[model samples]
Target: MANTPQSKKRARQNERRFQINKARRSRIRTFLRRVEEAIASGDKSAAGDALKAAQPELMRGVSKGVFHKNTASRKISRLASRVNALG
Candidate 1:
């Protein structure tokens, strides 16, 4: 459907970006799952550690444009509260 050469090139670039962003999103979800698992297991220390690991990954997702900044911040805030409440 991309008749123009420029359009074809853009389609290719968009596909590549889609793959990259998909991978990044999956990675961030994995980190979040770890935190959730730790929390569910009722291990405060482990949950805190997992949250520490996930926070930067989430922020990186924001920096990479895979996630919105406020979305990442809200997630971190909620997770931090859950971890703290475990104390």
Candidate 2:
């Protein structure tokens, strides 16, 4: 209901943050999907390249508070291993 002015302002801010976070999450997912597709296609080089491109985006998500640091680290570690295995 946000009867208080401060509450109303907070509600607005929350909505804005929600939208921004949602977009960031979607972008990160897109990068991850690219890596997955490259890996699935059995193109080791392409998968490696995609993983390289995605690494920063994943870390950015962590830095921006969109993802946990360990979660991002784990994802990067797992993806890197898979890419290496493609050799």
What are the TM-scores, per candidate, against the unseen true structure? 0.98, 0.98
Query: The CA-based lDDT of model 2 is what?
Result: 0.97
Q: Which residue segments of model 1 deviate by more than 4 Å?
A: none
Candidate 2 lDDT over residue span 1-87, tens digit each: 999999999999999999999999999999999999999999999999999999999999999999999999999999999999997
The digit string of per-residue lDDT tens for model 1 on 1-87 reads 899999999999999999999999999999999999999999999999999999999999999999999999999999999999997
lDDT of each: 0.97, 0.97
Candidate 1, residue 68: CA error in Å? 0.7
Clashing pairs in 1: none
